[model samples]
Every structure is written in C-alpha cells, then in structure tokens.
Target: MITINEAYVDSLALNAAAVKNGRDLVKKNKITKRCRTEDKTLLFGDCQGSGKEPYRCSVDYLKPESPVYRCTCPSRQFPCKHILGLLYASAAGQTFSVEAIPQEIAEKRDKADKREEKKKEAIGVGSDEAAVPKRKTNKAALAKKINAQLEGVELLDKLIRQLVQNGVAGIDSKVLKMMDDQAKQLGNFYVPGLQNELRELILLIKENKDSESLYTEAMDQLTYLHALLRKSRDYLTSRKQNPELAMDSESGLEESIGHAWQLSELRDYGRVQAHVELAQLAFRSNLYAARSEYVDEGLWMDLSSGSLYVTRHYRPVKAAKYMKEEDSVFDIVKASELFIYPGELNPRVRWDDGPLRSMQAEDLERIHSYSRSSFTEVIKLVKNQLKNPLSDKHPVVLLRYSEIVVGEDDSYGLLDAQGKQIVLQDTAYLAHATTHLLPLLTPELAANQAMLVLFEHELSSGRLIAQPLSLVTKREIIRFIY
Candidate 1:
C-alpha cells in the first residue's frame, strides 16, 4: 500500500473548509467500499452523499509525484470532499481490500492512454522523436488584424483625451455608463488590454472616497493608458507594413497592446534560455478583481546571471476549482528550456517541467553573492524602471543590510552601513505576510544578512517603501512571505 499520513492528507487541502468537511465525513463514517489495486497505484472508494447513491472517487497515484484526484461528485473542486474523505480514510488506516481495477475505469484509462499517445505524437514527443513543424504567421490575416487594432488604439486615445478635457466634475453616472459601454466596444476592436485598463480608469473615477488618492491613481492609470495607446498604435502600424516582424524584446509593446504571443514564437524569437537554474525567493497570489482571475506570482533569481525573473500562473475565478493552484516551491528548478516573456523589471517566465531538487549549501552562497550592496545604485535602477509608464512599478531587489531602523512614524526600514536607508511598509497590492515576525531575528544577524524586498511608491505617504520578503544569511534564506 502507498504510505500516507494524516498530516500529508491535511497538506493536500486547498481550504480550511474543505479539510474540515473531509474530517467530518470521516467522523460520520460516510466512506464505504474502499479498494486499491494490488500494486497500490490507485486508491478508490465510495462515499455516502446527499443523493441516493454514494459518490465514486479515486486517487490515482500511478505517478506518485503528480497524483490525479477524481470524483463523480458535482462539486467543481478538483479533489472534492469525497476524494478527500477517501484519502483521509487511507491516512486513518481504514481497511481497504486489494482488488482488480474496475472494468469501466480500466476502459477509461485505455482511452485516455490512446489520447495521450496521439497528443504526444502531435507534439513530437513520442518514442520516434519526430520534430513538430512550426506554424507560419498568416501575413494577410495578421495585417488586417493590425489595422483593426490601430483603429481601436485611435478610438481609445480619443476617448481618453475627451475624458481629460471634460474634467472629473463632469463624470457622472451617464458619463460612466458611456465610458463603460465604450470599454466593452473596445473588446470588439481587438484591444482587450486597453478595454481592461479603461474599465479600471472608470472604476477609479467612480470611487471618490479619498479625493487626493483618487486623483493620484486616476492620473496614474490614465497616464499609463495614454502611453499604451500611443505605443500600441505605433506597434500596430509597424506590423501593418510587415506582419512577420521580430518580437519586441525591449518594451514588449506587441504583447502590451494585447497581441498574444505563442511560446513557439517567443522561443524562435530568441527568448529561450537553456540550462537555466532558478530559485524561488518568494511567491504570492493576487486576486485581480478587474480580470476576475487569480495570478500566482513567484520571484525567482537566475543562479548563473543573478538577474531577477518572475513566473506567473493565472487561474481564472470561474475555473478556479478545476485548475490546480500553484503553491510555494522550495526546490531549485533546473530547467533545460526556459521561456522568458518580454517586459521590463522582472519579466514573467515559463519553463519546461524538468528536474527539481532541494537546495544545496552552494545555492545559499550564490544567493548571498547576488545581494546588491549599494542602496544608491538600487534606487537609481528602480527610478529608471518606474519612469516608464507601462513598466512594473513594483520592482523586487535583494539588498544587503546593516541594521533594521525604526522610523519615527513607527515603520520598519532597512539601513546599510553607510546610513543609506529605505523605509519598509506594506502596500495595498503587495501585502507583507506580517511585519511582527521581524522581532524574532537576532539584531546582529539582521544587520549582517541580506534581504529581498518589493519596492513600491506610496501615494499617501508620497514616499517609496520596500516590503521585506526574505531574510538571507550565509547558510540559508528564510522567507517571511509566500
């Protein structure tokens, strides 16, 4: 039988409620007919439910590292309460009879295997190792789309200018309604990105809670939207002339304008880096209310180049239950093929699933060396990136600190040996898990070690602040946020 513990079952829960419901099922003795294959590759059982018949569920561990939890329950959750109940039963050492796989499941598995083989053949990943051909861009179709996108860009710019000239006092419900309608129409113009931003701008205008704050954010959003329009128009115009142009590696304006990039295209455009080793410094999940999606963002450092990179996994809210949530990883990811998306100040990256192992002692030494010592240089670099309207304002950097300074405002800030200090505060977007955890560290260790922080420009304070993420010593890096 597959070895399992209650703690392991607990760790698999996506939410406290799910775990609680599962344990409740266990207590009620809802599970029955527990069985497993002779090899113990599959653990399956039926659990009594609200319906007349019990819900059939299985935990397929054919590939133990990537187990598949399946249940006939109507719940959208990947591992439904029934599946969890089964796992919890196994963890609780319930009696399970060894039996042959069900005929229906066996048939389903065979069909799935055939489908997998066909997919591998299509992707050129089969035993024969055939090379899949890259699809060429349809120039005529792409050029026509570019023209439409350019028209959308112009329409958006005109709307923005009208809004600016009319002033905030004139923005009533009718005006908001018109702007909202216009944003929806922009979707038909092949400018989903602009449409999203316009909606956000409209929302900012609608909320006048803090007038000063509203003015700051509204202006910032409007400024970025305006820049996006100009750059998008220029980009689409260029593509209109030659649709097969190279991907923009600099500003990533093509993608910024809502042009979806294929991984094959990015790779062919010289965005793939080989033999890249990345260590996850910190990870956070952000719910983008505007997009109605949850984005899992991980800050990673390139072990060889020591450059900061980001990995983003977006899970839409509607399909959140079906999709797996990307959690914090503690291993060193050694990817043979890494695809980097185009953008500034920590561009998003994706890599082929490959070797992952625990961090070694040498990994710590390399990470320590990557810590930037000069606050002056860090400030200059961050300022340059922030100047770009379309750039990510929250740039993450690792800083070597000498002391943790407590400001008169009762805020935490990091100070270097030469007395250059950067204040630390939790921003609205980047929530520091908890600043209270700072007191646990020894003052001497805190002074001598390096720290990873996310820099944000605080609108209310009118000052820049760094949100501390990880504290790094020579031996190991301790993370405060995920």
Candidate 2:
C-alpha cells in the first residue's frame, strides 16, 4: 500500500475549494463500503453521496508522483471531491484490507501496461541483449522533396522581387491577396514557418501603410525573407549530399523556414537532461477557421551548462482549457532535471519525470555567476545574435540598471551602468516595473537605483526592444508573464 500525504492531496486537488470539500467529506465519515487496496498499487473506496448509490472512487498509485484518479461521481473537475476524500482517508492511516482487484481497475491497468509496452517496442526496447536497428531512409524520395522545396523558395524570391519593384505605397488589396495566396502555396511545400513570415510581412504592410517607417519595416522583412530563402537552399543541398549531418546541430535557417523535428525522435536520439531556470514565459491563443491554437512559450536558462533553451507546448483551444486547470509549465518554480530537446544555440525542453523541487542557494549562485554583468557585453551579444536571420528572440541579461526612465508617452527605458540603454516595449513589463519595481525603491535608491533584469531583446525597424523576464529590486524579484 502506498502512503498518500497532505502535500500529495494538495497537488491532486483542482483548487482550494476542492481540497476543502474533499477534506470535509473525509471528516464527516462519508466514505463507506469495500475500501481496500489491491496489488499494492490500487486503492478503492465507496463514498456516500447525495445520489441513491455511493460513488465509486479509486486511485492508481502505480506512479505515486503522478497518480491516476477515477470516480463514478458526475463532477467535471478531475479526480472529483469523492476521489480526493478516498485518498484523504488513506493518507490518514485508515487501514484498507487487501482485496482482489476489481475487473474495471484490472482492465484499466492492463490497457495502460499494453500502451507502455507498445511505446517501448516502437522505440526498439526489447531484452537487454537486443539491439535497435537503424531507421531506413529513402534517399531518392528525400531528394525529390528537397527539390520541390527549392522550387517553392524560387517562387517566393520572384514574388519578393516583384513587391520591391511595385513599392510599398503601391501595394493594395489585390497585392495583399496575392501574397496571402502565395503564402498558402508555400505551406503546400511543408514550409509553414516561411509562410508565417510572409503572412507577417503582409500584416505589417497593412497595419503600417500610412506610417513613416512603412518602407523601412517592409524592406527589413524582405531582406530577412531573402536571407532565409538562400540559407534554406544551401541547407537542403548539404543535407541531400550528406544525410548523416546531425539535424539538431543549430540549423537556424531550416527552423526559420518551418522544418520541424519530431519530439519523440528527439527524445529518443538527442535528449539533454539538465536543471534550468525559466527566465521568461508567455501564452498566446488564436482562433482560426475550424480550430484555435494555444501556445505556451518559455525561455529557460540552464544553470549548469550556461546555455539558453526555449520550451513550447501547443494544443487545441479545447484541450488547452483542460490544461489550464492543472499546473502550468511556469508552476515548476524549482531546480530539477528537465529533458531538453536538441539544438545548438536555442534548444527546447520539457519537465522530466519527477516532483517539482525548489531551487537551492547554490543554484541561484550558479545562475548569477553565469549572467553577463556588463552592459557592453550585453550589447555586443545582441549585435552578434541579430546577424542570424532567425534570431528574432535572443535572450540577454542586464545585470544591473543604473536608471529607469519613464518617458512622456508612458513608455519606459532602462540604462545600464555602462550607459547602454534599451527600450522596454512590452506593455506588461512596463506596468510591472511601474507597479512593482518602483514601489520597492528607497528615496535614495529611487534617485539612483540599480535593478537587475533578465530579458529577450530584438531589433525592430532599427530600434531595440526589451521583453522583460524578471526584475530584481532591493526587496524582491518580480517575474512578468502574459
């Protein structure tokens, strides 16, 4: 039998109300008949409810850290109050006589085991002596695919040249429609990322049609597109010639042009395990014709490796709703080993199989030690990153800010000790600075306060903008997320 504690109960509850209601049920002795444990993995109980029959509750403790909960109660909340009550009673040291597993529970365990076995088999896990075979690749088929992609790139190049000749002022509804149509065509060639870039260019043109920097912004995007097209051609050629070249070796151009690596494949072949700090996080949702897209993005800094990683979780809006009710990726406010997907400059990662653990003082020290302290260093790094066509979101650390200037238009800017300044363009970060950071200042410090901040910086229309990750004042550190 597994020991369930209050910490485990709190983790399992949907919210504070659920915890209270479940504890109330347990205190009132609502749980009844046939409460037992089976195979040291399953716990079950009958709980009295308002209905004629008692609700059936069970907790599969096979994976104690991530228990599988089940109940017959008609509650939308996961695990329901009755399930929580059952676990609460078990945690309170209530003895459960050993019993044979019910057919329902047995079938569930069997199904779960079968699924796990199949996944292992797919990844070539057999007896210890068995060796996994290399995955077969059809070189001819791959060559044909690359050739088709190159054709799409050529078409994009022609469209870009035509747009430049027409001038930004001459672009109208018809031109915008043509670009949109061509972007859709690019998607047909498995280059959705490039298609996205094209769509963004069109949007930028439409939104800033009357602005003074319209021409500059349009040209910047066009230049980026041209570089991406050229780089993709080169990458594809090299990949076709040498199929053994590591795909995860920081092919920024390939990723920029929408080539993606399967997460399962990366986990099997190129996983990097480490403890990293989440420097920044953001979530965005968009409704399309048939479905909505939900994306969770995080900028993680590995304390041990001194490398930056970007982690993303995407789901349909309906599925996202369910996910929101549970712990978010940001909830892991601890130092724990995570499974990082492979990439040279900016890899992606996810939480590993363990309970979240808090960061130690040593972990914080390691992070501080690795941070770029000087403004000059930060500026140099930013300039170098901007040279990469796909370096739209490059991470930077401003170890200390010499001044925080609030502009007349309510915009904010930060000046480091070395006199380098960066504009804070994110409205959320500005609000956080005003509401949280400013109040923490002493009269003297407010006049000449030094603040530490982690941020992602990007160049837009010849201006640098900073999206704040965290701000450190004398009293506290505030993390901003949207």
Candidate 3:
C-alpha cells in the first residue's frame, strides 16, 4: 500500500493557484466519494464547480512516479482541481476505505491502456524522438503594423500642431465635426488609444463649461496626448527598424496603441508574481464617455512586498446592466499568482477569484507597517514620476500621519510628525466628498491614523494635492467613495 500526505499532494501540483483552490474545495466539503481501490492504485472523487453537476476525476498510481490523472472537466490541466481536491481529502486523513473501481472508470482505463500499447508498438520501443520545429515570428506582419502605427502617430502630431496654431476660441460645430471625423480616422489606422484621447477633448468642449476651465482642460489633455504620441512614435520607429526589439517593454507603449496583452506574454516577460497577498484599500467606478465603457477600478496593496496594484473590469455601456459590479472588499485577498500589466506607479494586477476570509489584527498591522509616514518623501516620489508627462498624473498611496490640520484658508492638510504638511483636495474627476466625512470622524480617530489617498499634481501651480478615499482607524476603515 502507498501512503499519501499533504506534502506529497502539494509537491504534485505544478500550478500553485490550482492547488490553493483545490484546498478551498475540500474546506467547503465539495469533495465526495473519495476512495481508493483495494489494490491501492487508484483514488477518485467528484467536485462541484460553478454548476451543480459535479466533475468526475480519478488518479491512477500503478506506476507512482508517472501517475495518470483523468478528469471529465474541460480544463486541459492534468490532475485538475477536482482530482487534487480528492487527493487532498485523503492526505488530510479523510475517510477513504478499500473499494472496487467503478465499471465506467475501469472501462476507460482499459481503452487508455490499449491505446498506449498501440502507440509503443508503432514507435518501436527505444527509438529517439525527432526534434520539433521552433515557431518563429512573422517579421513581415509585425513590420506592417509598426508602419501603420507610425503613420497614425504622425497624423496625430499634425492635428495637435494645427489646433495650437488656430486656437480653440473657434471650436464651433464645424470644428467639432472635423475633430470627430479625425478621431475615427485614427481608429482606422489601428491607434484607437489616440482616438479616445482626441474624443475626450471633444467631450470637454461639448460639456459647455466655463471657458477658462475648458481651455485649461483642453490644454492639459492635449499636452498629455502630445507627449504620449511623441514617446510612442519613437518606440514604434525603434520596432520598425528591429521588429523584435522587446516591443512591448518600453513603458507599455505598444499597449498604448491598442495592444491587448495576454497572460502568457506577461509571464514570458517576467511580469507575473507568485503567492501575492493583497488588501483592497479603495475602489471606484467611472464612465468613459469616449469609449462607451464603465470601468470598475480596485486599488490593492501587496502586504508582502509593500507594492500597490490595481484591478480593472471594463464593461460596455450597453451591457453594463447585465454585468455585476466588483465592489469594495474589506477582507485580505490571497492569490497564488498575480498577473501584472504594463504601467507605472500602480501597474494593474489580476488574479483568479476564490474564497476570502475576514482580516485579522495581524493583517492590519501589516498595512500600518507599509504606510508612508513622511509627506516630504512621498511628495518627492510623486514629483519624480509626474515629471514624465506620459506617467500616471494621479497615483494613490497610504499615508500615516500625526494629525489632520486646517489651513488658514480652511483647506485640509495632513501633518506628519516633523510638522511638514501635505494638502488634501479633490481629484480632477471627483468632488470633495471626503471633506464632508472629515467632520464626522472623531478627533481621536483622525489623529495618529492613516488613510488611502489619491495624489494629483496641479500642473499650473506645481502643487501636489491628495484626495482621501478611505479613512483608517484602529478598528475599521471608513470609505467615503465607493
């Protein structure tokens, strides 16, 4: 008879995430019929996934070193979570008595054995295998894309220069139509990212706000777009000369031109991290009128590495009613793998959903330990990143402070231990809702505490301002914005 333990079962799982999920199945009592054959060569059971119909799975260990795992699940992964869950049950000393193999499984094993025997006979037992051909990149296709993108960026540059020369005082209906038409043209050239930015400028004009504020918004949007275009065009030209020169690695310029990266590609570029633990510090849902989509943004902090990550779900405006929103999560999330996207500051992260438990005191301590205590240092970091026009203008962080103070003009600022002050203000797109919540907080909780803040740099005044999203006390977190 063979003996199975937790260590042995864990060692068998190549995908750590799958193993963790399998553990959850066991904890939920989803595994059933967990038993082994009298010969001790088989282990089998059933596990419920999303649907009520349980997936059937079995493991054949006639040759333990080369165990054969079978499952009815659609997953191509061997020893699917169902099988792992069954084995985990047994490893945890769950009851598994000697039993006969089911007739269906027995028949399947016989057929598999016959097929294996036929393959061995056809291959003539000890012959060396032929080397497989390595798949190569089609340089012609990639070069063509790079050329189209470069042309599109050049067109954008011409449009911006014209807008500057003519000025926006004449942004009437005729001018709006021309801008709209140009946005569509950019889309046709495969630079939809630029199209969205251009349409955003159009949307600002149509909002019919104060002229001065409109001019400021237009100037800022165009400046960022102009900088983004110049940087991406240079990157595309570099790829045009050397088609395989780490194209997507240049500050995610390729993605800016509408390249949707796959998880395998991110993993190949060493962007995926294993065993990531995150806490959702804040969340928000925003509508992008230009793109016709609603984006649900979740801000998460990595407790292990003290890193910030963001998760986004883009729902089309037409289908948004049918799609459920991913709202705030108060518990700590543990994920075996976190897929990292290309961006700066808070690069987007994604992970498979699973069961989560309520956070404990230890988790709170970890959050407090990772917070920034010095406003000066945090400002310096934000300034450095904001200097790059292409970088994220609004970056978020957790700030621990000695007290919250009111300025001479009734403005809010966070006071650190050394008396340095960081102003609190609203984000460009959001209202000052956090201000209303400030008065509601007790003085004891407001002093020597922490909060989740989104920092934005005022381009005209060069002042770094923050918007509080959530207030953290010793007991619980109060979120002003959802």
* Candidate with best TM-score: 1
TM-scores, all models, native as reference: 0.85, 0.70, 0.72
Q: Model 3: how far is 232 from its true place, Å?
A: 1.4
Q: Pick the winner on lDDT between candidates 1 and 2.
A: 1
Collision pairs in model 1: 283-482
For 93-174, candidate 1 gives per-residue lDDT tens digits of 8899999988877887788789978765554443232322345778888877877888888888998999889976677899
Q: Is candidate 1 or candidate 3 better by TM-score?
A: 1
Distance from true position, residue 298, model 2, in Å? 2.8
C-alpha lDDT values of all predictions = 0.81, 0.64, 0.79
Model 2 has an lDDT value of 0.64
Candidate 2 C-alpha lDDT tens digits along 1-482: 34578777877776688889989988999988535664578888899999899999888877755678898888877778898888888778877878888899889989999998987677554344222234566778877877787788788989988988888778889998998889778877867677778887887887755465677667778888888888877887788787656554444565676767654455455453434455332323333321245555555556556566666666566654334343333333333546655444556666644544454556555544554546677767776776675564455453556676677876667676666776766532223332334445455554333333434433334555665555544433345444
Preferred candidate (lDDT higher): 1 or 3: 1
TM-score, candidate number 3:
0.72
Question: What tens digits encode model 3's per-residue C-alpha lDDT throughout 228-301?
Answer: 89888878888788865764653756666778776656655666676777888888888879999988899988
Residue-level error in angstroms, candidate 3, position 231 = 0.9
| True-vs-predicted CA distance for residue 81, candidate 1, Å | 1.9
283: Cα error in model 1, Å = 2.9
Candidate 1 versus the native: TM-score?
0.85
